[model samples]
Target: MPKTIIPFGPQHPVLPEPLHFSLTVEDEIVQEAIPGFGYVHRGLEKLCEIKDIHKMIQVVERVCGICSKIHALCYCEGIEQMMGVEVPPRAKYLRTIWSELHRMHSHLLWLGLFADSFGFESLFYHFWRIREKILDINEKTAGNRIIVSVNILGGVKRDLSTEDQKWILAELKEIENKLEEVKDTLFKDYTISKRTKGKGILSAEEALYLGAVGPVLRASGVAQDCRQLQYAAFSELDFEPVIAQEGDSFARMQVRYFELFQSIDLIRQALSKIPEGPISVKVKGYPEGENVFRVEQPRGEVFYYFKANGSKFLDRLRIRTPTFANVPALAKMLTGIELADVPVVILSIDPCISCTER
Candidate 1:
């Protein structure tokens, strides 16, 4: 049989983000996968040099639509550190609630797309239908579905009233019940297991060396999660990182499914412990010096670096997104797998090309 090189995609049905791979295949087995990035570069990082620190928050949030809030949160945290501003306790809890809410929405979105990759259209619809509830919550509270800019430098821009909190409690309960129903079918379904199990295997050692983050690293039983760093309100919440030892596509899916419930539990905890106080403190003075902040985003660990020379405009701003870190893992996972399983394998990392390019 002759060896052939096939382009996996700058555009494809299974991938929502643009990622190109030159796959060398022989007898339907991939020998090597060469990756190409920067398809959607918007020069977001460079814009920070011209944009003021406050305006840079909006630009950073647009780095990845799925995890927009987390991006803004990381940027705000870094800037706050540089300015030595202490966030209100209420604002901290609010940040936790919105972060977990976004996590749930993001995981659900990935689940739907993962199912769609394997041709489980019905499951895809079921997952997305439930996701709408989360979007509705975002719109009702933050005034936007995806890029809800609730965070300012000192604290959150909006507050969740007692009545609104009660509504959220009730809504979370309903979403929990709905997820339980799907959970039963998702794990037990023979088709899903057959397609996912033993496919795109990534060992624990390889994952750590490649710097895999979020569920991808968790699935390999690494027990490492950025959330455990006690950032924001996570320190106040009682939670554990979900771990699985399989290190395959199925294990990755299981890790995310478990995280969905974990996020719901974390949200409930935040709501219960939320103290009565102002949502924001007055932010004064320009940021001075340099600092870095790391947050556990839906995909994995996202790092933001800020350098301010006592000015309104940042001297330098850099973002290290999870997708960029996970690309090495993606390349390793593709080697020796069946070419047909490429889409599903690539999706297991939940690569966001926009975030990578930014």
Candidate 2:
């Protein structure tokens, strides 16, 4: 069969970010896929040199809108470590609640987009509609929906009052019930399973070899999660990384679906055990050393490295986003799959080109 070169994205309806993949296909089966970047690349990392560490937190938060809090949290934790500042216990618990809520919002966004990729319009609408509730929660607690600049260097900028905590728990209960109602349609529906199951297989070996992270890695049966590092308040709460063995597109989706519930449970647990105290602490000096922090993003593990020279500005800052690590695995998964399945397969990784290109 003659081979054909097809461009998959940069502006494809299914892609939420600008990721261009040139797929070589013969008889609809992809023979090879070459990914190209830079369309939406923002040189945010380079800005650390000009922006003070305090201001850089805001810049880092913009790395990806969906996972903004995680990015800011990781950056703050690294800076705090270098400065020898310990976050308050109450702040730690608050971080966990917001982090889990961030995860929930991100997964819901991806779930809707993934469904839309495969032509499940109803599922897409349903997921996004429920996600609006999460956005409302963000606004009520953090004062903004998308960026939610609540994380600061010493700790958090916002506090959940008694009334606020009660409201959050009530909202989470409603979200949980809605998630249960949609579980069957998302996982067991013929349309979803038929297209996703047994498609875009990424064996455990390939996933690890390619450095895949997040739901992509978890779906491959890897129990690795940065949250297991017990950062923030995760140690205080009961937590477990969701794992799936199939390593297919459906498995990836399933992992995220189940994780939505897990995140909800985590928020509930954190709120119940939250200690009442100051939400932030005072930092006496500038960050003077090097430290690394990792957090479990909705996509996967996100790493932030910060090096300081006892100055207000950072000496070096580096970030390794999950999508960047998962690209090689995405290329591997795309090979040998039907071209028509490419969109679903790509969505399975929940690729965030902005995060990758940042």
- Tens-digit per-residue lDDT, 1-358, candidate 2: 9999998878888886778999999999999999999998888898989999889989999999989999998988888877779899999998888888999999999999999989999999999999999999999999999898998889998888899889988898899899989988876789888899999999999899889998999999999989989889998788788999999998998899999989888888898899988999987778777788888899999988878898888888999999999999999999999988999999889999899999
Q: Which residue runs does candidate 1 get wrong by more than 4 Å? A: none
Output the lDDT of residue 200, model 2: 92
Instruction: Quickly count the clashes in candidate 2.
Output: 1
Angstrom error of the Cα, residue 182, model 1: value is 1.1
Output the worst ten-in-a-row residue range by lDDT, candidate 2. 283-292
Q: In model 2, which regions exceed 4 Å deviation?
A: none
User: Per-residue CA lDDT of candidate 1, range 32-76, in tens?
Assistant: 999997789988888977888889889988998999999988888
Would you list the C-alpha lDDT of every candidate in the order shown?
A: 0.92, 0.90
Backbone clash total for model 1 is 0
Provide TM-scores for the models. Answer: 0.99, 0.98
Instruction: Provide the lDDT at 264 for model 2.
Output: 89
